[model samples]
Target: MLTIIGLLSTTFGVSVASALMPLISVELFAVGLVLKAPHIPWWALAIVIATGQIGGKLLHYYAARGSIRLPRFMQRKKAAERKGRVREWLDAFRANCRKRPAWTGVVMLVSALASLPPFAAVAIIAGWAKVPVTTFLVTGFVGRFVRFGALAIAPGIVSTWV
Candidate 1:
């Protein structure tokens, strides 16, 4: 039981790191664990990793929402100080997101599952768009759980065919 707890803790830590740092690649780590630690259940790994990922992404979400203060260098320019077609387009898109929140949630969920627009970017965008926290949490979690679970179990599933 202690060993199981330790493994879970490790998965959580690595997953959080991977979420914060794109280069870390938690998917690779999970697949490696499946190959090396056959004793751990794939679904358990998926849940732990997904929790850690969501926790890490929450920081980005909050920061984008201006709930978490950032250093001057990291902060975006003030809206009044910024001007451009891109800015206007972004403002329009944000308004659209607010008007069609369900659509935004679906986009976020798809990004979480497929990394189409990139989950990291979507996390920040969802915050900047003022997406409801509950929606972000639910969609992101469900997508991530399914994605990581599939990866964690893929090796065993494939090997069984041979």
Candidate 2:
């Protein structure tokens, strides 16, 4: 389970996060039910997933909150360019958030569904848009509950297939 959590924490790198979720869910759900460990209940598993979303979003927030000035040796051509687009997009997302504060929850929910690349983009946008952290956490919990609930039940339904 700790290993699964670690993998999830590292999923910020790319689409690998989305790809690995199903496998992790299935494995964790199975292990929890099979071993029936008193310390690790099914609900706790759900919380891990739910809380993980917040952690991922925080990571995304930190990554996008700042503009890095790369050192001469390690800088790439691409890194040196595109400040305009990044600022533009961030500005637009902020404007959109102000228009519809509630919609940030929808964005959080959709992000989980789409498995959009560099998900931090969305997370950063949400934070910059001034979406309340409390609201983000609540919406994240709902999204994760749905996801974890689905995964928890899926093993039984697909028992024949697996």
Candidate 3:
């Protein structure tokens, strides 16, 4: 099905660019617009895109967590430092978790909503923060569903309302 293909491709694309958050966000936004056209049912498109993006984020987060091994060229001592960096970042997040749970949730939610295309930055940060995986996935799904759903519907809504 076209929907399945779109979801699969979008997930692959977003996952591949998780490390390049700043760039992919914009591209995803544009792609969302294109996917919103009349030919595509807004619900299907939104669901597919939202699910795909979340799936991609999880993929990237786990990849960064070192589940996937790097190439020999990339496995030098300097590269190994990245694992420590991830630990440090996770520590920083844990330190703030108790003192600022509400703020953390709000900020993560906003960041997830506002983040462009891939929105991997929020996921990476969440992972670094060592936030519970459930929390991250829930916020991500809700934020993305709202954002992509709005993108899919706003054009029609405005055209009719205005």
**What TM-score goes with each of the models?**
0.96, 0.55, 0.64
Which lDDT values do the candidates have, in the order given? 0.92, 0.54, 0.63
lDDT accuracy of residue 33 in candidate 3: 50
lDDT of 1 by residue, 33-131 (tens): 888887899889999999999999999999999999999999998889888998899899999999998899899889889889899999999999999
Best by lDDT: 1
Worst 10 residues of 2 by lDDT: 11-20
Give lDDT tens digits, candidate 3, residues 104-146: 6776677667774335666766664566777777877788777
122 in model 1: Cα distance from truth in Å? 0.3
The order by descending lDDT is 1, 3, 2
Pitting candidate 1 against candidate 2, the one with the higher TM-score is: 1
Candidate 2: C-alpha RMSD to true structure equals 7.0
TM-score: which candidate is best? 1
Give each model's clash number.
0, 0, 2
Q: Clash pairs of candidate 3?
A: 25-116, 25-117
Across 1-162, the per-residue lDDT of candidate 2 in tens digits comes to 545544344322222243233334333533454244333344555555556655656655544434434357744345446588876885676787778876767777766544452334566665546676676667666766566656555555566586
